[model samples]
Target chain A: MTAVAGVAMANEPISPIAPVKEINLAQVELGKKLYFDPRLSKSGFISCNSCHNLSMGGTDNLKTSIGHNWQQGPINAPTVLNSSMNLAQFWDGRAADLKEQAGGPIANPGEMASTHTLAIDVIKSIPQYVVEFKQVFGDSEINIDRVTEAIAEFEKTLITPNSRFDQWLLGDKDAITATELEGYQLFKTSGCVACHNGPAVGGSSFQKMGVVEPYKATSPAEGLAAVTGKDADRFMFKVPTLRNVEMTYPYFHDGEAETLTEAVDIMGRLQLGKKFTDEENAKIVAFLKTLTGDQPSFLMPILPPSTDSTPRPQPFD
Target chain B: MTAVAGVAMANEPISPIAPVKEINLAQVELGKKLYFDPRLSKSGFISCNSCHNLSMGGTDNLKTSIGHNWQQGPINAPTVLNSSMNLAQFWDGRAADLKEQAGGPIANPGEMASTHTLAIDVIKSIPQYVVEFKQVFGDSEINIDRVTEAIAEFEKTLITPNSRFDQWLLGDKDAITATELEGYQLFKTSGCVACHNGPAVGGSSFQKMGVVEPYKATSPAEGLAAVTGKDADRFMFKVPTLRNVEMTYPYFHDGEAETLTEAVDIMGRLQLGKKFTDEENAKIVAFLKTLTGDQPSFLMPILPPSTDSTPRPQPFD
Candidate 1:
């Protein structure tokens, strides 16, 4: 353990407090541009924003993420907002850092499906990109590492830390309403705290979906089974942060429920083995809305030049 | 001619500048939302910005504006960047004011191609849009006239003032480069100033293309012929403003030339009956670039709902 000095802290960092890194503004700016560019995708239609859109709670409101081939992924799209806070990346903790996460979608057969050489070539083609890359990377050559670092820097800046929950936690009593406060009390008492109780609310841990009642798994996704290749991990998935959960719907590993009310009821039944009345559900829904904070005008990273100008095709087109 | 009682400008106003009505921000904001909205188009795909995009110099880089049914217009899409100052509307000057101009596109068979009634109905269908219309119009009821008024108000805000030319006029010596200053002098002396001089640089007047050189009958467009059906008006068209001309490329009414250099050569040969050498062309191009000023972000009046899911398209089906 002593041999791997930083590796021990890598999994469970000394506090949820972030370790500050001197960021390159140039890289962040370039990442902002690349994040908005659709050229990164094979079809040139599926931008990073297509799935992890900032305007829409950082996740496109789809049950499963639609990609270049219009092929839907098994799991719901994770919100990119505050994703920098994650100890490990992806629903099943596949990537150890943001840099690794950045390369995942580009080569994913269902997603961007772009080779590294092709992605770099496409980016180098744009005059604006050329100027920006030269400014950001300096004498260092432009490649996948630089691309990942730029994107990672940009992801770090997407920390939405001033929500009402944060304000309430910061001792602003009036930040949350009385009903929302009561719902918070109910949340703790109902034993939802088994997995979801942290600064990110739930991303600090993972839990099996059918802890009490069978989750009645309807999604085509085998949930965490694809990642673990274990039958026991079949229904297991990451416990998503509820930071902006109100805006990100339908809820769950597969976006089966359209509204928070239905999702809360399902959670109560499956996760806690508690049946809630309609009035209780309404109160929880009201509490969830308070979690949805105001977002600033998203200056859409200038739309990257696309190879094709058509709707994304599906099923490995 | 002295028919109207309160029209004092006709007799003699102290200032030659007409008293234009101030723009209503509330209406302009509404109009801006409507302007960028693809829902206004039949395919629910195209918006005003689809053609007059801001990032790409207020005009889509396409040779001609594409519309519904993939039909291409004969004339190049003019920049809305600073179009508010134009004396008349469109290449042929058919529309008298911004309101009339705004109305023309929606109803035009080759443009948005929606009737005012259908447009309003389409907007009203979206609950968020319905709320925005109510807030802006004050229950005045959604109508074509209101749409025109809102769009006109928005267009007034699209004014691109304070170019290097404006700064130079204001006694800023370093506002424009030395080559641009020399080019300006040449522009004035070359008899090009006969019609291409005004507040908007060229929007204040109309002129016959190739006035000195018997107007050609070879271009794709018959200029003002389509509007008036008069043989004399065949080659007559409004001289476009050079405000953000550097960005809005493929110049001229027909977008015949691909670059500013080529456009300059063609204009010198056909209109001025003189040839501009490479050095002279470079100077003129430099001067045109200096005309570009910073374009502020067009603040959309209505925002999409906080939810991640875009309200599904229900226009056609």
Candidate 2:
């Protein structure tokens, strides 16, 4: 982690996750249905939940996601658990917001593999969705913008608050163990806190993958360089939020590190130019585990059935 | 809906769907998780919900299902909602119960494409599941039998009661309109109720696909003949429950019919040596729409993360 911004090494660099109170319930409810609806994809088998699954820390729990037609994704899909906190979306930081990011996967050939027109057509064909759009947006129009907006609104509600760390931050003395507290101390002193500090614990900035040394990326993705077309931006990616990181495994952009211990060791050697003892790495890992928050518990949305007019899913095609 | 038994059709042929009272809560909960778990598959992509999608009337709303590696399913997927009322499971009635049916898809090459051993191994590797199995089964052992039993218990709770038709059956005069009431009368008088009786409106009997005439099946599945190896049993498939038939589209074993009217028409011509008028078909379709019940609204369970020892899903492989 490198490009530290928003929160300097102030008195409280890492803030406790605040509980959300304000949200348009109708919009959120509509968005939840759309989020789980796979008909948005050409295949009708892959929904937004396909990659960013709510069950397993908002990730598909795959190293790299299996996409449309079983096409292998190049990079490890990021968790959507607290993704709203990210400065930008994607490993390349190409999309500026969740709404913009929502549309990318639906059309991406290696992802949901459906174009905007096709998705809109499919959604509009379902009468219930048309009604829902009218109710949410005060119009009967079903367009890509509104669709993405609804999805983004739903994503906004995906904030995971009240981890043991947050409880500790709020002055609960026994919230974390002594070893975990020591780990937190080591994490701050080792300079890991510089970039990985925020309400989300690491999503406010784009940072080079290997700050101290060159990282041997297993993926072909060039991170921010792919977007910026600058050599300096190469290997730079949006620092992923560490909230519920315990459930999101096979760590890093390439998913090269399968375990937290391996990931911690790699970060130490590459990001901070420091080698940690096995005990030290274990301590840091324990601290990271404390970041596991209370996951969002929502009823599995019941999607409206497709009508005769609705275009059929050409999954094999 | 043929070979009606259990219900004599003496006083009331079609009974109101009774509200469920007794169910194994712990087993049901555990089963619900497993039902939604895609890790049972080789790809780790397809869950039981993929085909029997609870969102869309417990059916995928596809003609046939799209399965492992996007292999097209041979028959239309039956709704899991109220599936417990069915006398037997699967289109051909090959599986005697939900437990037996649950095991079929896991190993089915065209479906989930994972062995029972592989699925059990995956479940056993996850510590949370191991603990849950112990709680539910009174032991820490993870096996296919207990796994399927829990799934069966969960399926048993999938009984969807309180449809408008059920309300109408329970003496609510305004629960249905004149047109729907007329259609229900026609359904009984025209002999449609002979097969599709009982609380499920179907199930409890095996019937030939085409009783009066031959049907051109879209897929090559042999129906009951494949299991029994008897020429007399050829095309004799289990009658699908018409519960939530509105959502379970592209009706029949072949999934060729796209609309309820079309399915009704075909059934008249092929099964009853009759042709339904357009108005009659519409009426029946309207009455069928009244069968849509309150879908199971359960909070999406947060599944335990896979550990290093867990076998990786090989979608491409």
Candidate 3:
């Protein structure tokens, strides 16, 4: 182990976030419009931005989301920022990718609450949307597949790069403070890094919410069991990314913890069976706060006006 | 009469739309963030943009707006574009200016449903917002007065200029077609210009909906009388701006006319006691469409994160 320990690897660590990469301009723009357009929902008031708001760390900041008909979301909304790095989509990791996840919320009874047929029909009825779909897909047809594809393309660009920790990892010595460095050392030495180690600092795999202690969550979600139907998978949930964790508040699947310090304490006790000193918790929180990087910036998209043929929104019965 | 009528007027006519003028950058930026931030509402899901959406001709395109707890609005929302030119605010002209109008919806029971105290407390809790308020107001205090002022400053920049009609009015004779020119002539000769004349093509004065004929409306709104508490002011409303009229659908205070042709037909029949031919209605409608102008474009403002001190939103009672 000592003989190979000092050798430098050829490949750089992926945890240090990278800058914006190549993207399809047309698809991203089309997807951006769809992301902001609320007509895709039955109520026509809740857009993708309504839940995954880019303005505030790509989250609604509520303990749980307020969905269609003001129904409470089953779980705390995971941040959409840097979500492309997740192994799978949703807390249960039920969906394979963002494309699959994009289609779920629009038709979910507690979410946007609109069927694919109705959403497609609304898009088809708008003449400008028809033209835009033709421009992007080279076809007049506007369907769920094309819609999700465009939205997923847009989601890929929502990466937040150049955090202080990332800068430190990229060889800038002054990017992080000495306290923060000590906190980083503790983070790696502790069992916390076992599951939370990738570019997203988590989300590389599904892990049980509690290992050393049982968690009595108020939310009735069964986690991975709902997807796999296996008793062993119960309470197994996708670990959320720690990138921009400062801004994405009310942490954890149930969102019972309200602050980063509270979340840290709860996680350490439940997941690691360790009691962190107040100073240790403060240092770790300070380190986590440095993960907030540059946010995605773009003009609020101008949506097309509905024509006479466009189906009117049924906001209330 | 001939000697006095031939003299050229020195003061410019305020009917033809002009380009966007000066704006306060810092205040507008602060206000833009507030305009898009939903925390101003009790539900933390509605913003100024929810109803006055700049993306679609500064109107929500609903027959009436869906407000707090899904309560339906009493009157159709007026387009915010070129609203600074309006003599007063709201369909009933209750608020004296944009600044006065900005505070109404935030506290209105059926609208944002957030009290002034709660909204101020929420903003004050965010350190970044405190800094922003300090930057704009030369003081650290954040209040309803300051909030409304900043919002009004931003709303002033919502003007839509450089329309085809504006280009024509500004000496580009070829900008409009022959039919459009005929429509403009009819607009002046038929006395429509008496109420619908200005840089905004309307919004200059309060006018009765039915001038020559008694008109029946489905909406129970009493218009100006609701504010003035006078029987004579019944059905009197501020003439809505015709700028981007094509995009502001379900026209008039009642939002009963679903099409521009229908709107024109109703206006002529009720206001002037004239029955316009189909060709005349088409020409008038075509001219109105030329009023569609450049929309306001800017990066969506990233909102500051809420702190522990920030009051949580109470969407449901």
Candidate 4:
């Protein structure tokens, strides 16, 4: 298909990340409020945005997240941008979809540290939330499922479109520098595209972290093996998206790599079994930087106030 | 001044809050990004918005704030909306202005737990922040002064104006219900108007929490006494704004009162030595609800990504 630049297009492995054009605006609006409302957490301070912050490439930029009661998270937070493109959610592919993934943090003991019952009760108590829920769901029935569904819908709209790389793919040669173009070529020719080829440039499938070498990490997570109960699934993780990888740093599930250069070095050694020259690494890093795209822009949602009937947030308790 | 829905105008004791008409858009925009950027916190999880959230009446909606290491704050976090109207900042009036007040939480061990040095270092390390700071401040120099100044400036734009009560004060006869009008009259006849009269309906002066009678609260905070060495300042708090009191619930310095009616009851018994009937209290509560005004509406700022040179956040360390 011809792109906006009217340049001849070929069958490219990676597709352009498309901007969200149509959605249930009411549901999206409701979800935006829920996403920012910290009352969902037991501490009455942590919201979904606390970890997956839209301001910072939809990630907290933390090695491992600080959660309720200052509990350290087990794994690094994955960026929420273009996350809907993932075949399955989470590093281990435990959750089936975005909706299921959305529920994990709120209930997790180390995360939001809130019970589903308490969360539902909090929303139900707010008269304004009740009215909005009725308007969006066609009834005043507020439940965890509906809450997650709306949140997931809002997340789907967080796709970052029109990156410089996408422009280059659309037949504008000047979109990227010569070094970035060289990096792109090397990334493809070096066989890194096999697993990292998709609209999201990764997340299409689960892959072993260290194909050529045994990976050692301090985390106790067994990856997909914990979910599938298969010994072969150990150390297998859903490849994270490379889109906006420049911003979502401290890479990998363990968050051992602090910089892109270090991460690229480790990946070259462990995954590809190729020790690339420093120049080659720099070129690839330059290309990765081009993945930074247009972030979603929208008015901050004004949440409805809690009334006397609403269950008060137990921040201290 | 003539108001819409023309009615007889008079010199009201309280002036209607006016919307912000003039501002440095560039600085305001930069400040918006900084406000939402969590990287300023030591954990890189808490932001200024974490406590002064724009979504929920610019508060975390907890009786007391939750801070670093999950510490329970000593006092309630006041709403950021129309806070610029305060004669001075904080319950104790310790900070001379909003800019000074902005610096307190970031360094407070119980709050963000980030030092000014570290916060400045973090901002200075980010190349994009450097650029934005130069654009807004006419120099690349990044400091706590500029950071807090920009934040306070953006905060000035957070004034919520055009409440139904404000409309009523501007000669719109139908802006308020008859019961609400009666409630306002009672509020004046009682001594509440003495402390709560200004453009913001309060924040004009400091007053003792308990004037005629003793107030028993669990909080150990002595209000202005903590700021000043004088014992006479004990329990003297800067009267909080009544604007948007409906949304800023769990009223008072200690946040002991969970509802407006309860707050009114306590204020009457302690400050005025007069307990009102249930009907009178309900009318006051209804009138207070009319103070809910137009919340600030603005696009959520998308923060620039941290570069390789940027200092990594120490969430765990």
When sorted by TM-score, best at the front, the candidate numbers are 4, 2, 3, 1
Highest lDDT against the true fold, candidate:
4
Q: How high is the lDDT of residue A186 in model 2? A: 96
lDDT of 3 by residue, B75-181 (tens): 88899999999999999999999999999999998999999999999999999999999999899988999999999999999888888887777666688899997
Clashing residue pairs, backbone N/CA/C < 3 A, model 4: none
lDDT of 4 by residue, B117-161 (tens): 998988988888899999999988899999999998899999988
Superior by lDDT: candidate 2 or candidate 4: 4
Q: How close is candidate 2 to the true structure, as a TM-score?
A: 0.95
Best-fitting candidate, measured by DockQ?
4
DockQ of candidate model 1: 0.11
Model 4 per-residue lDDT at B192: 84
Ranking by lDDT: 4, 2, 3, 1
Q: Give one digit per residue, the lDDT tens place, for model 3 in A88-202.
A: 9999999999999999999997999998999999999888889999999898878899999999999999998889887776667688899987877677666778888778888
Minimal lDDT window, size 10, model 3 chain B: B3-12
Predicted structure 3: clash tally: 1
- Which should have the higher DockQ, number 1 or number 3? 3
Model 1 per-residue lDDT tens digits across residues B45-82? 45676677654566765556666544566677888866
Candidate closest to the true structure, highest TM-score: 4
